[model samples]
Target: MGEGAWSCQQSPAILLAMPAQPASSLPNGVVQSEATARALIDAVVSNELSAFRQGPLSPAELAAQTQQPVYRALRCIRKWEKMGVLRVHSVHKRAGRPIRRYALSAPSFFIPAQVLPLEDVAGIVSRPLEQQLHAHVAHALREVVGLQGSEVFLEPRRYGAFLVSAPGQVWDGSGENLPVLANRWATLKLSYADACAMRDELDEVFARYADRAGPQTYWLHLRLVPETSKA
Candidate 1:
């Protein structure tokens, strides 16, 4: 191993002797800087890197876990360290060189709405989910006999967006039994209490099916935003 290599053996007494930062000193996971927020978002949404959320990890460990290049991981760690989003959790002496482990300064991060536009942030976060949904539908159409030749599309309405799926020519031509896609929309007028009750009911339904095991997997995106004149 090189001078920077770390060993499994660590002295508990030495580790315990090191002065630790008080928990109260941390940022409480709220990130204010736009640059740091953007960097963290990019790391998550783009690379799917989330090792830092678990605990302190060396750059090499992060690279191995995320499948990112070691240099890239180190670069991000260094950048975050400078931005105060990450801190050195501990240092271990290995072959006369000190190996540092980095962890999130806070347990998690929250970007304030004032720091970035809600619409832009939502778009950035939802892009990957949209892509994944499309890819899954495409794969199912190719591989699943029942869903073969089905069409999935998005329809943007005046007040809301709709994702619709329809049987294609092949499926329509065949009289064999297959799953049917439902298309329905309605404008509702409800009191505050009724709206809250509806929301709670929907949440319960979601929670019930959120983790169920199934032979096939599906994705669902539900939004219940208020409709405005500009919408």
Candidate 2:
């Protein structure tokens, strides 16, 4: 841990705080984005409820986890309710006030692009592509290979990268947040929404590079995996 470097010295339950995503009125599955897909995939794979279901959560409960304003949380709750994705689990009169608790009708009721854990084994299963990213990446790799006498991949150190992790973990979310040596691998923990924005922004950067007329090639690789797994 050098100066300004972050060390994973926090708890596993230490959550990543985020501002509310301005509760939207769209129906489930209507406003699909990579973030939504990622969250859905995460929830399914975890076999656990999302923060939204930290036990029949009220808007306040959701707000607590999301760090969203209470009003925004209420808007999101109402939207899901109207979509019939959530059901009133119970209502109680507490200290002269009524409180409502809502539960997801089914885990899959509102999730987008779901694949059951049993059906989602990456190496053992072959999934049909939902888009062209895989095909295009393969095409690009072949084209790079065919070009003769190219300096595209010279200086291996410029492209050097590796993983650092405990043997049984996908990632330690508690990893450092402060700036560190750029020469080392960077570990990040981001909310689904933030992750989505990073993906889109990076795509834009790559698009700009593709439009340039020169041959200064680069390779960037990233892998995202969950934090915990085991028997």
Candidate 3:
């Protein structure tokens, strides 16, 4: 854990104590505009990727199994492939038949492990199955690619199995109302040092959209998977 990395058990008190502190101390571009964060969170929490696995699926099956429209699902699938989150293996097939199966590549992280707790992260989903799988993948992507916090998931593993925890003091004042906003911050492309300087502005942005400072607790998990094997 880093300077802001505390446990959920005492996050509220830590948050209040640090209220006067400037958000500028956070990593560069770590927080985002409130509106964008909310959009990202909504897209994530309501997404049907929880239902998808690194397996074969017919076009009809893919359409029926996901919560998103076929177009969006197709688009997301392609994006995941490009991001190295999914590996599409071309299985040998009969002539004239299209290959229709994919294997997920072990995930790779764009950041360092010090950025997040890879061993304790959980998915955004509520069910055990989703939490174990899709949730992990979602959090990893959100941590690495989204805004609030910056992290990169390193390897293959189910969500929440490793690297899940609250944000501690980072988003302490925000509860359910802050995920989307936080995600936006993570997605922004700022350096860690510059991001720390804008914390107050980020907090204020959240305040404007929040309904009564909804439950103060750290719930953001910054997890990263390493690219190379460690001894």
Candidate 4:
């Protein structure tokens, strides 16, 4: 078989029946950004394409479903195929021309923090859902007196997720006893193994509460980085 070509002997039924694998389970499943990755995933899991989610699709079919030009669709599929995010499920001969059909190599992808450009990060925060979150947080802070000059904003980071800042002191509506917002920075010295252990422990703590039923929602962000120089 030629490169990128698949034989018809591979059962389409078996391929379609295989369960979608998570990004962590597949090599090359981690991406730097969600741009093309998110769109492809949506194409697979979206209700509009429910009938074909499990099966492979031709570039023309993907173009129609994604509302992109056929050439562009083919180019994207080929690029993803090179990245190992997609693979040829089969090729069909139509009118003596071979048409390639592709399927996602994995259904899910993971994008590491700080991998997106600054503008892309800004674009994400500008989306409707994030805008709503900002509005809600702002309204709640407005009732608290000491936060008059305080503002919550994103701090661009070179090595991790954007750091959210609400600099200076923040007080609850009562205005005296304890602060409602917590922001702390600490310098730690630890062996590599100890650091990894600490991170694993924190992951467990986050996972423990990740799916708990609750009346209120809270956002928590954490980062652990090695210090390179004194500021």
* CA deviation > 4 Å runs, candidate 4: 1-55, 60-71, 82-85, 94-99, 104-146, 151-169, 172-183, 189-197, 211-220, 229-231
TM-score of the candidate numbered 3? 0.28
Candidate structures ordered by lDDT, highest first = 1, 4, 2, 3
Tens-digit lDDT track for model 2 on 1-231? Answer: 111111111211211111223233335324244454344333333322356544578778878877889898788777656655456777987888688877765433332334323233231112222123356445553543222321322254433222224322222223344211122254579897887777677657645665456554333333334455671
Quick one: best lDDT, which candidate? 1
Candidate 2 residues lying further than 4 Å off, grouped into runs, are 1-49, 94-97, 110-150, 153-231
**lDDT comparison, 1 vs 2, better candidate:** 1
lDDT, candidate 1, 80-192, per-residue tens? 78877678889999898688998767645566778756565656656777787677656544543543333444445333433223442223323344333323456778887
The order of the candidates by TM-score, greatest first, is 1, 4, 2, 3
State the lDDT of candidate 4 residue by residue for 113-202, as single tens digits.
Answer: 455444443243335345555676666665555443544534453222222224433332344642254444567889999988887887
Clash count, predicted structure 1: 0
Worst 10 residues of 4 by lDDT: 1-10
| Clashing pairs in model 4, backbone N/Cα/C closer than 3 A | none
Q: What's the true lDDT of residue 3 in model 1?
A: 20
Which residue pairs show backbone clashes in model 1? none
lDDT, candidates in the order shown: 0.58, 0.44, 0.38, 0.54
Measured on C-alpha atoms, candidate 3 has an lDDT of 0.38
Q: Model 2 misses residue 170 by how many Å?
A: 29
Better of 1 and 3 by lDDT: 1
